[model samples]
Target: MTDIPLSTWAAMAEIIGAGSIITGLLVVLFQIRQFRVQQRNAVAINLAQTFYSPDLAQALSLMQNVPDGISLAEIRARGPEYEQAAITVCTSFETMGLLVHEKIAPMGLVLDLAGGIVSTMSRKLARWQEDLREEQQQPSWGEWFEWLGDQARAIKHEQPPAHIRLDQGAGGS
Candidate 1:
């Protein structure tokens, strides 16, 4: 101990401090990388799950059969199946919109899955929503539906969807 001067102790302390700083920085970098990997995994899992949902498939089928610009009365006359299918589609899109808006899910991913149908249905159902809102005395009942449609529309501006090639073999377009 007598051989070591105060200067040596001070130098040792500085080296220790520098080492700690470097270690802390490394830990932070590692954590960031871990978070990104988790996010990618999350996106992959969600994509697979959502794509395989029976409700989504049923909804798409209903959308194809249901004519555009039909009134709520027509849907009611068509019976519960029609109403249920439309509601299921809207509800799914609404949840998707909320997820994207809240950053719980990536917008591009959600759009890739259902953007076209979501936008079309929102437009088709605008009148129904308006009437329903008036009946309930709440104007915000289906705001998320509109938001999702609007966001999808904005994306169209960046890169026109028509440019996206559809593969008939894959059942696209």
Candidate 2:
């Protein structure tokens, strides 16, 4: 066999080196995408856990009887427990709202999970939230919670309930 020229060998080596670099970069890009998906899934799981925690469940149970447009004074008049329940609910929604707003959690997932509850609770606590904000002189108080509630309400209006949406057996096995 004839010997290869040095210049030709150098060109072939450069092509191989470039191909290796491109392959490594593609691998890195894929890994980055996978990492992002894992991170988002982890966040979603944590949010779900928080939503279903015993404390939140208990708070929701307590607040279930709260009338729509309940006032802060009325909540305080009922007892400290009611007020505490309201705080728990508001803070939980606030966290969820912040997460959604920051895009750390997707809106579709959050709304699918707790949109109804958020809308209902927000309506029930609207007055109380406003009163608390005024009383505390903190305009940002419960801001995210209200935002989340608004988002939930808007989505609720725009889409049918899940049962209805799934009535067509879109995901039936």
Candidate 2 global CA lDDT score: 0.94
Residue pairs clashing in model 1 are none
Off by over 4 Å in 2: 170-173
Query: What lDDT does candidate 2 reach at residue 146?
Result: 99
What total of clashing residue pairs does each candidate reach? Answer: 0, 0
Which residue runs of candidate 1 sit more than 4 Å off their true CA positions? 1-4, 162-173
RMSD of 2: 1.9
Over the stretch 4-72, how does candidate 2's per-residue lDDT look in tens digits? 998998999999999999999999999999999999999889988997688889889988898999999
TM-score of 1: 0.79
What are the lDDT figures for the candidates, one per model? 0.77, 0.94
Per-residue lDDT value at 161 in model 2: 90
TM-score of each: 0.79, 0.94
List the RMSD of every prediction in angstroms.
4.6, 1.9
- Model 1 gets an lDDT of 0.77
Candidate 1 residue-wise lDDT, 81-157, digit = tens: 87787777777777878888888778887777777777788877766667667878989877888799888877856
